[model samples]
Target: MRRGAGIGAIRNREMVQAKYKEKGAEMAETQMATLSRQLAQLRTSLESFAAKHGTKIKNDPEFRGQFQAMCSSIGVDPIAYSRGCWSEALGLGEFYYHLGVRIIEVCMTNQKRTGGILPLNELVAQLNATKSSYASEISTDDVQRSIKKLRCLGTGFMLIHLAGGRTLVQSVPGEMSMDKTSVLGLAETHSGQTTMSLCCQEFGWSEDRARTALNQLVQEGMSWVDDADPTGERVYWFPSLFQAVRSSG
Candidate 1:
């Protein structure tokens, strides 16, 4: 009787273990399915964004190369990166479309010169007219948000004050041009090394300041540092900086 009871208990334990194993497998499968769906949604969004922008973002070499490098470093597929670029371009295109419509209206009404550029006041009036048509769409708040987004993507406009009370809004080209010195400093400090703190100590900067500058450079595509240091130190380098150094010599 004792042996029979013991055998029954052993079989019950085995059954419980098998049930737990099946549940674990089901959970893993469900998680994978969820991830797959999310990725699909992201891809769709990216493609839609690109489609809205026309061909400018798709064909821009500098933009494409920087985007590809960043995406590759972070393990994003090349196709996905292309889609993201398109999406970003589409957003900018929408703003430009509105602006272009206003410009055409202003040019037709005020200026007899077809090819010659108009003055700053005329441009501002056109922009204002455009803003008025889509007042709900082009509020001050929206402009601020758009500017922030553009800055993140390394594109922005600067208001330059010219002679005789004129202001011109010009596009700032290339991330490197805007932040060259700081980017070079970061690349120099982190080249072939990791851990901004160690670099900071070697270069006589506070750890916090060094980290901030280094992170900014990394975001701007001038340098890169690994997130993890299982090997006891971080590593950093800038491919562009290396090329520049080689070319100069």
Candidate 2:
């Protein structure tokens, strides 16, 4: 009715929009400042907690786990601090560094047999065996955390999740083809032995495809050829599973 919107009205609307944008920016800045203060407080609190319980954190795995969880909840990484107060209070930097070294040593020591793919349980057992009886026991959580930190080295220190709730650590950096990994799954489920026929039947793959996958793994030294089968077919056994299969048998 008032000649639709006049130029003056449009100018007024623009001014209102500009004001809202300014306010929004101010509010965002305020929120960010508040968050920064909160984070500082959280870090201070964690530091105090660590300083008070430094001994327990060093000697008690459970206490250390709880402390770590608290730090993780706030996006804090004690291990990253590597030096200064946090490291001194938590002992995280030195402890995990040493643990990471031990883990890699174990993996390297058994690399020939495992092809750098070792089961998590075996790794833990060998590691603890190397530790003094007076030393605190290392848990899987500890190994996993240490490995996570070791990933920066780019050596492919990663945990592989496979079928049947089995976790394997891949210490050597290598590519795992889909077909080969699938065949490994079959091996894991069948007492660590998978043959050409089994792979073909399980994955509905062609004979050539199955053979290629099995052969690839064998070439990688991850699989051993068991040619003594009564059926005359070569059984590809996973070295990582030999101990388990043998113990079970």
Best by lDDT: 2
Q: Compared with the true structure, what per-residue lDDT tens digits does model 2 show for residues 1-249?
A: 465668779889999999999999999999999999999999898888888888888888777888889999999988887655687777778899899999989999988988778888888888889997887888888888899888887867988777677778888877777787677677888887889998888889999999888887788788899899999989898988776677657
- For candidate 2, the lDDT comes to 0.84
Measured by TM-score, the strongest candidate is 2
Cα distance off (Å), candidate 1, residue 108: 52
Clashing pairs in 1: 49-86, 49-87, 50-86, 50-87, 194-234
* Deviating ranges (above 4 Å) for candidate 2: 1-5
The whole-model lDDT of each prediction reads: 0.48, 0.84
CA displacement after TM-score superposition, residue 127 of candidate 2 (Å)? 1.2
Instruction: Give the alpha carbon lDDT tens digit for every residue of 1-249 in model 1.
Output: 999999999999999999999999999999999988987676665456446634544344345445444444545544323345454554444554454445446544532321212334445544556555524333322232233344455544333343334332223343333232443444434432345655566557777776676676555444556657676566556553343335445
Positional deviation of 217 in candidate 1, in angstroms? Answer: 35
Q: Candidate 1 has what TM-score? A: 0.31
Summing lDDT over every window of 10 consecutive residues in candidate 1, give the lowest-scoring window: 110-119
